[model samples]
Target chain A: MPPPLKAVLADDEKSLCVHLKNLLQQAWPELQICAEARNGVEALEMIEKHHPDIAFLDIKMPGMSGMEVARRAADMCRIVFITAYDQFAVQAFENEAVDYLLKPVEPERLARTIQRLKERFEKRDLDPAPIQAVLKSLQGRLAAAAPPPYLKWIKVPDRQSLRLIAVEEICCFQAQDKYTVVQTEREEFLIRKPIKELVDELDPQTFWQIHRSTIVNAAWIDKISTSLTGSYVLTLKRRPGTFTVSRGYRDRFKSM
Target chain B: MMKTGNKLQTPCDSVRQKDFKPMSPTLRQHRKGLSWKDLGLTALFSTIIAALLTYVFQDESFWVYLIISQGIGLSICTLCRYSLALFNPQTSWGIVAVVATASIFGGMLGGTVGAWLSGIEMPIFLSKKIYTLRVLIMSLLFGSVIAYYFFSRERLSEIRGLLQEERIQRLTSEKHAVQSQLKMLQAQIEPHFLFNTLSNILSLLDSDAARGKTMLRDLTRYLRASLAESRSQWSTLGSEMELVGAYLNIFKIRMDERLQVHIEMDEALKEIPFSPMLIQPLVENAVIHGLDATIEGGTIHIRAEQENGLLRITVADTGQGIASVPSPGLGLANIRERLQALYGGRGRLIITENQPRGVKAVIEVPYATAP
Candidate 1:
């Protein structure tokens, strides 16, 4: 009755996703198998499309890591991070009371996790605040190890040849399934770089993340208006579509 | 009086025993004993003194003056050698006493002997001139001057020897610290790598048993090669390549079909004894920074060539490209340091950007020079 209790799985490795999916069916047979994503961009898209009750996120993946996706997902779904083995990730998850599954996930462990998820959703007392805290701390730990390098130029595959696009020319970035559409004032081009990656690479002061899938250049904004739903919607100076600023990121907009 | 010299005998015996063993045949005449070499040197030195005294007095023969000078010289020289044993070198008063006793005693012995040989008779003692308080006091002054010179020179040289020893000790410890630092760097087989490989092995065992067995074999070889190599200064180029091969093979399984490796090395060059960790870190850098950073992954090409009295080994990768790769400071710096240490300036590590994509690292070391 209640949407058949859906869940989404995400990992770069196809076999790993399949393996986890098979194990998940044994643990929660009643749960509907909605979708599986091979990368962080696809994972975020699946979460948005399905509005699933849970997401099994692999912490390490190219383009966008599971932690980055989790940061953008906010309160969208309950997160159960899967890591091969990261000491800092393990400690952060434990301290934050966020669930994490080590690789080679045993059936018994999966059953326990499924049971906990069912109980939490049934009670509906689970909050997204600790997930936010855990992810922030993990980011800090990762940055301390090696600061994320700023990207100045990105290579975009063109129709017949390749084009090197400078970061300054880009007005906004919007996620399109697995690829990101890089919008410049002159023209819009598509790139395989997910929105999550641009968040790390682009200068945070100029390019602001207004949506899980959209990041807009601050100088190119038409205006930010508060919708009747009390959420901020931003439109670019030359760009057409209005980008919704989710509640998780609205604080950055409201203060400005 | 002479029996008491036995107590003062030990310290001098211990010190001089190690040096000039022939001269110190015995302290049998600690009061006035000398080896023939000592006697000849003493006779020559005393003659110089006797000439001076005879020139001043102008009354006695140089022979009579020589006997007195010889008595004082031999007595003071032999006794001063053993003198410090009875007294602390730290005390001035103790030293004056040693000098006074030896000089005056010798003056009396030689004066009395010379007076007897020359057939002079006296009321209570022979040669009142030699026994005069003036002569005894002068003997004490001259003995003190000579004693100060001897001790000062000895002390200066002892201090110099200590300073030399200290310098050698400091240099040895500095060498030790560098050695330990190298050992620690060598033992840096990343735990994350080990755990990740093991985790993959566990997963594969359940789903793909055949691949699991292959990974296990590769892992075993990797562990053994690394463990054996780190403990030794050098390993054969072939074994090191085997170690690198095992390492990449494990990574291949873990990365799925993403990783590709091509190793080109001459069979003749494989027997060359190369520094243990030189090429391994460069390969690791290629895998982690050059290849692992990209989702599509890439290829690692390792080639070793021997030519013109030099061995050149290069590890080039095509994954993220050189522009995308950040400077991997520690691993590369470590390799350079090792190269410098093992081959001095003869060894070299050169890094360049690989065309199309990735990074190329080359190591050059003299083939004829090895550990």
Candidate 2:
């Protein structure tokens, strides 16, 4: 049998890193884990020092991002990125032909990535062209996937025709059973969905999650008020009045 | 004209009466319409006119001198009122005109009394001279008054036009600010959502490819809804809940038995409108900030009710609660700002600890039946 392929695992979560190392050993008994790193900077140093044939990188790290390390260590070894965030940066990984594993990494997916890496290594002339194409496709998909950032109006079903709702006129949203009720200064409507799914499509920075199921538009929070019960609540400048801040979310008021 | 004047006077008098009814210490300083600088200027002008009249009539009898003094005082008073009309057009001109006329009449009576007291015979020529001086003074006073009126009126119109222009500029800037914020919000939501969904897809590819395929279809639907409503300020409650359900379904696949969601809402509130994507972020926070930190997983509860004329929505989670790090996060901050912009002071959001050990958020908005 050919000599074991040497590798290093780099991730912030100690347990996850250990688990991945164990899986690598089990899957390819010949693969040896040369080193382990908790962050991107350490991963880079370890990769440079040991010069492992493969490196597993976690996308988010304390000091450096996984992409930066991958870019720098491109010539040294094969790269596999592990991420909790998948969609936004898929194209980035695709462009480099770097393998990526979404967190909580599964054994089957990890094995497939390893298999692909082994095949490329054996060929020696692994063209990055396919990866580049994938990246281009991902970019196109992303562009075509969502509405343009400048959208100003949303259409909701009214009596028979669609009613146009101006974004600036909405007040807040309330979750109903299997639906989300939208409250504006003028009217209300029931949409067929839950709150969690909508968040992926909405901007997190603009619409804040103040509670477990309540998201408020940042523009609407007039001032944060303290209640008689020693809890904090948000007072909006709009038509409807005060909203209470659950004790769990009180930490959000430390900056206020 | 009289009726109009009476109507105007009633409001003005009412305002003036209200202003003068109580002399609160805090409001005392602002009571006087004329500033110290204006009073000082008026006094200075009166003194100058008095001195000039005294010098011009030094050789004449006291009676003639008094008449000349009256003429000069009247002329000076007219100048002061005319100057005021030119400089400060917004204030009532009636008061200034009355004061100038009173001063002229007072000077004439004083001069006549002084002349009679001095016992100087008034020459017929002196009367002619007085009349000529009065004519000249009146002509000069009226001429300046008319000229000042038109000049100030023209200037006032120009200033009013400028103020209107400035107001338009301010409104435009405010609109731009709102639009930019909307754009930033759009950028933030899409990427974060996409990233999370893609991660889920990746995880599902191994064990349940069929489920993964369904998730993809759901994702496409979710994306389309998001894109369609991305720029909208508000959406129907029903639509928002649909989006939330889609998110839960996706998470249910990944979280399995660890995640549970319960929603409670009144049926009558189905048509209520609210900001788009409002509830989703809160649900997301429950997952990412609360449940994600724990291994045991948790349950999220959403409740909505109408109180008084307002709709109140609440989201509760049974998890580790908020992190002790004390950061509101960009997502929360954005929600607050958006609420403020949309509802001014009418909408509100609150976050608190749940009964057992989780986080609960409440959102309150005015209830309107139709758009």
Candidate 3:
């Protein structure tokens, strides 16, 4: 048999990297793991130095993105992308025509991708047209779509199931202990997400920046009224309705 | 109204004018002033005391009878009224005390003759010691009753006023808090959005210049929408979806083929109003933490449905699942807090391991109509 296909694995997650390496060794004992890289730049360097026949690339890395590395390494070796993203990037992958594996790297999927890579190597015809089209479509979608920064709903753990909460139904989001709470019209649920991350994605129009630790739904606002104690308080249109906006956020109501 | 006139005409009014003292004290003192009922009760008690004294002194000289009768009646009546004013400041007790004092004194004094004629000595018939004790006790009891009646009536009115004031204060504070918080939450959404979008734009500038131009236009639309309602707290679901679509596109550029997104929403719920930016963060988390960490790209499915009286939205990814590092990223946490602030106890977010693998984030909120 032609000398076992030389390969390299690149990923930031140590456990996953090891798992994939083991799986590869099991599938093709002769396949040599020439080098391992933890990031895109390192992966690129290793590919350049070792000239591996095949490379498994993780899309996101600290130094350089997997795509950036792939773009640079496109002519040098066959690339198989491994990632956890969705269809929005499918076009980009398709444009590359590079074999890709979804995360949790199923053995069967890995085997198929490897088989395809080997077949392409033998044929010596790695067409970049499909990849180019996919990339174009992805870019088109990104350009045309409007980004909603806010989260409209969240899925929470329930009894053996999950609960979906509409963001509008929420009155306030409060950080408590280690978890953030989603307070709504009927109940409250605890979730393990950071406040900063939520702030990044929420829509600016409906969610108000009340304090460092709190975000309020603007629709729930009844009015801005001064407390007898000379502080600002928020009144909700709902029952048992009142929340204090910290002094730091007082300036936020200038327009209101 | 009549009592108020007397207060305004009083010498204290002149003092108030000169001092420019707060009106609260004067108003309170005025409220404590005696009314018609108090005066009537005082007069009745005085008369009964006078009559009793006169009856007791019937065998004594007229001068003695007159002196004792006038002295006791006047002294007791004046003292009872002053006591009513001082002790029962709340008014209800004052009324009860005044009325009770008058009734007891009048009944005892008026019935003395009947007891004397029933074969009993004038002093022994009413039992001088017992009569005196009874008079004192009855006078006190009646005085308290009078004071209580007046006190209760005044107290009820005062309580009503206080309740009204409290209600206003409560409403005012609540309004302010809501406004401030709304502003804060609104403020928090834009910066991160701009940052992420700008990053997307940067990425697109290199690979596809035409797409970058289009993305810039979309960004402008998003910015316009965000600025259009710097003060609005709610938006149509359709508009929010449009915003999410834009955000997803930006991610699509950064993530390239490693990310797949699917949005499944009920057509009927599309018109419903929801918190803006409510769905975008979950999708972001799926891309950044869930899918970004994996070597191979995965699918992010966002599904919205109306079940029971609630709206259920799910963001699921076939990614690396929760990080093995035992800590979650910040995006999911922030989304949860925003939900809580908007819904209080009504909203919920659930996170679980998706079928086969990956993570699923679900949010549920009561269906609310636009105000």
Candidate 4:
């Protein structure tokens, strides 16, 4: 009775775009594929020209991504993300209140997405609250997805040859006078890096700030025992000395 | 030590003082045997009270009457304190009840004994009303004072214990929350590149089966190696190289021969330990930013060597060199952060221009062998 639902499909892969278009044609006979874009840039232009009712977009494209296209053309049409990410990674979309179809789109899953879109069109209800929430959640996920810098290796100076130490091998670091003493299971080395700076660089989960002068590897810790005076003593599995956990840093061992 | 004249006297009924010392429940119920200190303190206090009463009564045996009265009063006060301590009663009502009962009982017993000891022939109740009332008032004062002291002492200690327990509980929960949050963040590894590569492989499967199979094999190898290496915090240099090899295989499938990688690792350093997922990011950066930009693909040369007490790694690509020192992106920034965390100031990353063209990234860390 109503005019056919018009939609735009965008994907960098021509094969995938064609495949999705065929699937859509088979699932909903009344639907019209008004535009097909090979990339995000093309998709944006097509949306501006056609002003379609729905846009199916691949999340990652060559120059721009589906998320970017959604942001620019959000007011014009409803957006559905196409992604290759696993279910765990795609949980971000659920939080954003956005609809997403996983890669190698199945008929059953596509039908569900179509059903929801059809209901929204029939009701003529376009609420911006969920779209706003999705945008905020998308920003958060992007920030989290941005990988932070981490240490790869350490250069330790030995007697004759300069030794390369893996950061993970060092069991603990103790600050002495002006230098930090880096200890592994077998030997100890001195470095100019202060305990304070090392604390910032090391992974907080693996290397705990147990004492003011000591940053210990959680894996290397043998056991933590409370002394008669209520102070905590941390013993390392492969090392000789027992480190004293100061009152201020005792909270790190609160679970123990 | 009963006196000859006091033999005919109604034997002074002295209540046993129950002491509340920290002990096992079984031991707590059994009172500690009277000690020499207890006897001496009681004797001294009784003597003092007797001397004062003698001045007031002006009787021949006024000292004996005061001694009996003082002894009974001290015993009742001590008993009340012990009962209240054992029960751990919080209400003011409990204290009031203990004091009221102890005072009444002590007043009657002590007044009767003191009157008989003072050689009063008649019953004390039948004697002068003022004398009996004075004895009762004296007993009440001593009993209440000692009972009140014990009650307040217990209340103060209980409050202190509660405050200490509350502090420990709050700190423990806060630490647990922080540790779990760190774990959650660490577990969420960004798999953006991985999924994209997978999608490419899926498209290639139907179009070019042979290439898809090769890419799938490489992807499997990469996943297996990476997953195994990530289980532990450390990995060998040999294993890290293999992981890079696997990663390059997947990238080569997408880029074809456009991405050429040549790796030179010192045979001696193969046995040396390295952190997992370290140098791979640098190689990735070289490919994505450097080689991807050039018209024709460029070669990435990766070399590692042991210098004077330090290990040096260099990744150079033959692509268009940057005009200026550009700000570090996610990959370079990640490497910098990781290096800073591992070696503090000792760990260094130096970026420079290659001889002909492209950018060269050098990483240096202390050379230490695995135990």
Give fnat for candidates 1, 2 and onward, in order: 0.11, 0.04, 0.03, 0.08
Per-candidate TM-score against the hidden true structure? 0.54, 0.44, 0.40, 0.42
| Residue B32 alpha-carbon offset, candidate 2, angstroms | 20
Candidate 3: stretches off by over 4 Å: A1-158, A162-256, B1-129, B132-196, B275-299, B315-371
Residues forming the 10-long window of minimal summed lDDT in candidate 3 chain B:
B1-10
**Lowest-lDDT window of 10 residues in candidate 2 chain B?**
B21-30
**CA lDDT of every candidate:** 0.70, 0.61, 0.63, 0.67
Best by lDDT: 1
For B257-278, candidate 2 gives per-residue lDDT tens digits of 6679888878878778877777
Native interface contacts retained, candidate 1: 0.11
lDDT of 3 by residue, A1-256 (tens): 6777788888765545666787788777778999888778789999999999888887757456676777677777777777765555654676556578776666788788777776787897676555445445665554433323346556667677655555666787888878889887667888888677787767767787787778888867755545434355676655476677787778766544
TM-score for predicted model 1 compared with the true structure: 0.54
Name the 10 consecutive residues with the lowest summed lDDT in model 2 chain A. Answer: A145-154
Question: Among all windows of ten consecutive residues in candidate 4 chain B, which has the lowest summed lDDT?
Answer: B19-28
Tens digit per residue, CA lDDT, model 1, B308-350: 9889998988966544443433255556556756676688765
lDDT of 3 by residue, B89-154 (tens): 323433554545654554455335324433346766456775555345434544454445555757
- Separately for all candidates shown, the number of backbone clashes (residues 3 or more apart, or on different chains) is 1, 91, 152, 27
TM-score of 2: 0.44
User: Candidate 1, residues A1-256: lDDT per residue as tens digits?
Assistant: 5657888998776556767887888778998879998778889999999998889999877667888889988688899999877888889888988888987777888888888888888899579998999978877765654543666556676564455454555788889999999877556788887899889878798788888988888866655655535577676654567778987888887765
In terms of DockQ, the best-performing candidate is 4
Give me the runs in candidate 2 sitting further than 4 Å from their true place: A1-57, A60-81, A84-256, B1-177, B180-189, B255-258, B293-297, B319-328
Give me the runs in candidate 1 sitting further than 4 Å from their true place. A13-15, A145-256, B1-189, B321-330
